[model samples]
Target chain A: DQQVKQNSPSLSVQEGRISILNCDYTNSMFDYFLWYKKYPAEGPTFLISISSIKDKNEDGRFTVFLNKSAKHLSLHIVPSQPGDSAVYFCAASNGNAGKSTFGDGTTLTVKP
Target chain B: GAGVSQSPSNKVTEKGKDVELRCDPISGHTALYWYRQSLGQGLEFLIYFQGNSAPDKSGLPSDRFSAERTGGSVSTLTIQRTQQEDSAVYLCASSPQPYTANTGELFFGEGSRLTVL
Candidate 1:
């Protein structure tokens, strides 16, 4: 069973525009959510994360918002750059459980 | 040298052969993890190691899969009698600890792709 899901297979946006990627989870036990960006032939790289206690977190140009009631989360990239093009994955963990479940990634393409 | 490193970046083998993949976690990191990614699929959890304690191998797909972490630094994943279904990219990651206070973020190595004919 897929505990986490990213419905969009791919997305395209113009440079300097806002890019939004969405994710949803069915596990209520997951307390922490993270977003990772992966490039070709490389492993996923940590981008940003949010705790269950907070509804939103922002780092530089990346922002993550969580809606506990809806079991949904989103990653938003402002002023998207060509270099930001990559596959984005959403993952979740439950503290010491130490095992993270990932969603099928969304490939983002930024046209310059 | 600074981040997690995996060896045998690419491997191709015939069916019924066994394959071994290796991972070297960053220095001083006590937590290690292994995952597999198939084409057009998300990362699938395989195993986790913390220090000298036992590893969590719950996500292992079958009895043919086994892994071992030695000296709390390096790990090797072994697949026996490999089949075409075993072909995928294997990834390794490391963290300082299990919780958010010390090692919430995981540093991953470029995956090793295995192809079984």
Candidate 2:
């Protein structure tokens, strides 16, 4: 069973526009969530994350919003840049160390 | 040397042959993870290893797959009698601390592509 899901397979946005990626989880035990960005032929890198106790977290131009009641979270990139184009994966963990479940990933493309 | 390193980045083997994939986590990192991604699919967890404690093998797909971590550092994932269905990209990751609210991210390797023909 897929504990985490990213319904969108791909998204395209213009540079300097807002880009939002959504993710949902079926397991209620997940207490921590993270977003990762991956480029072609490279490993995924950490992006942003939020704890279940918090509703929102922000870093630089990326912000993550968590809605616990709905078991949903989203990553918002404001003024998206072409360099932001990559596959983004949503991962969730149930207060564990290395057992995070990942989504199928959403490919985001930013056009200049 | 710097980040999580996985060797045999590309391996092609015949069905029924055993294959070994290696992972060297970042120096000083304590938690290591193994995951595989098949075509058109998401990352599939295979195993996890922590310092000196028992490894978590709950995610292993079958009895043919086994992994071991030595000296709390290097790890090897062995797939015995591999099948064509085993073809995928195997990824390894490491973290300084257990994935928690305090440490929410992992450093991943580029991944080892295994092609079982």
DockQ of each: 0.66, 0.70
Cα error, residue B69 of model 1, in Å, equals 0.7
TM-score of chain A of 2: 0.98
What is the Å distance of residue B62 in model 1 from its true position?
0.5
The digit string of per-residue lDDT tens for model 2 on B55-115 reads 9999999999999999999999999999999999999999987563465788999999999
Regions of candidate 2 where Cα sits further than 4 Å from its true position: none
Candidate 1 structure quality by residue, lDDT tens digits, A1-112 = 7899999999999999999999999999999899989999998888988889899999999999999999999999998999999999999988753478999999999999
Q: Please write out the lDDT profile of model 1 over residues B1-117, one tens digit for every residue.
A: 698999999999999999999999999999999999999999998999988889999989999999999888989999999999999999999888864453257889999999999
Best by DockQ: 2
- For each candidate, give the interface RMSD after superposing the true interface residues on Cα: 1.9, 1.6
Give the Cα error of residue B33 in candidate 1, in Å.
0.1
Clash-forming residue pairs, model 2: A97-B99
- i-RMS of candidate 2: 1.6
